[model samples]
Target: MIVTASSITFITPQVATARAFYERYFDTWSPFDCGWYVLVRLGKEPDAPEIGFMEPRDGAEPFRAGGMLNLTVDDVDHMHARMSSAGETIVIPLADNPWGHRGFGVIDPAGVVVYCHKAIPASDAFAPFIQKGPDVPRGA
Candidate 1:
């Protein structure tokens, strides 16, 4: 099966807050605000990933905790500085990972963990696990 597009929808009481957070932090995203629901697209391309925020429906459980969203950026350090200066909560301080990334984690207003990172050379321990392929898309 070939996958075309993807999105993640979060049920939260603070739909507006979540939408505002994405709008403020992720500059490239465009939002489709619809009162109780907000769909934020990552880029101008039609196939760009989207994140949806919606008010919990009757008997539906709102997202409380225990999930994370990984967002790769061009410059993790710059983003870290921007978020820091904005007084955003940095739950995990920026650090290098053996799996080939320099990243940090921030908790959104809706309690979702957004792990922001940039690619870095993998450590020796993880290098063998890293794979390259012809079908893999190149250049973010």
Candidate 2:
């Protein structure tokens, strides 16, 4: 199947606040404003994934804490500093993990988990999660 574009939509009571949080923390801007719905993008890049926020409609359940949004970046350390300076809640500090990543996590205003990571040399513990071939998967 061919995929065109993709986004993760969040339903929140604080639509404007959530939108602003993403804009400030993720360095994104809203391109589409539909009153109750806002679409945020990283920049002018065509392939950049859009992060959307929407106000809950009637009969809609309130937002809850679930799932995670993982974004890979070039420098997790720089991102950590920038995010901290911006007052974003850093749930996890940047550090090298055994899974071959230097990463950190921040909790969004809507209570969604967001992680930023960069690749690094795998430690010995990474062997279980690494796949050797198409037919063989690790950590099953």
Candidate 3:
């Protein structure tokens, strides 16, 4: 099946705070707004995911640390610089990983981790242990 659209909603008690944090950090504006449920579209394309936040319903499991919102970016260094200068919470400073990515991480207002990264070739020291793939996507 073709995936037409997508979104990842974080259930948190800090709805307004989460919305404001995403707006400030990602430069997004909400197109759909509900007091405890907010949706912020991140891209100009029609199919872009509408990242949102919702309040945990009664009897629902309490918020728990699970997955992260990983954003594949064109320039991790640039993002790191902007995030650093803006004084956002840098959970992980910029660095290359064994998985062949150059990236950084930040903690949002709700304490969820947001990782932004750009693909890169693994360093020679780490190359043998890692699988290789196209360093850049074709036609990118």
- The candidate scoring highest on lDDT is 1
Query: How well is each residue in 1-140 modelled by candidate 3, as lDDT tens digits?
Result: 98777788888888899888777656577888879788887766666667888888876553577677898877788888988898888988799887688899898766688899998986777666654356854323
List all candidate RMSDs to the true structure.
3.7, 2.8, 4.6
List TM-score per model, in order: 0.89, 0.82, 0.77
Error of 1 at 136 (Å): 11
- The clash count for each model shown is 0, 0, 0
lDDT by residue for model 1 over 13-118, one digit each (tens)?
8988888898787854655787888898876777777999889888889998899999998889998999999999999999999999999999987789999999
Sort order, lDDT high to low: 1, 2, 3
Off by over 4 Å in 3: 123-140
CA lDDT of every candidate: 0.86, 0.82, 0.78
TM-score, candidate number 1: 0.89
Using TM-score as the yardstick, the better of models 1 and 2 is 1
lDDT of 1: 0.86
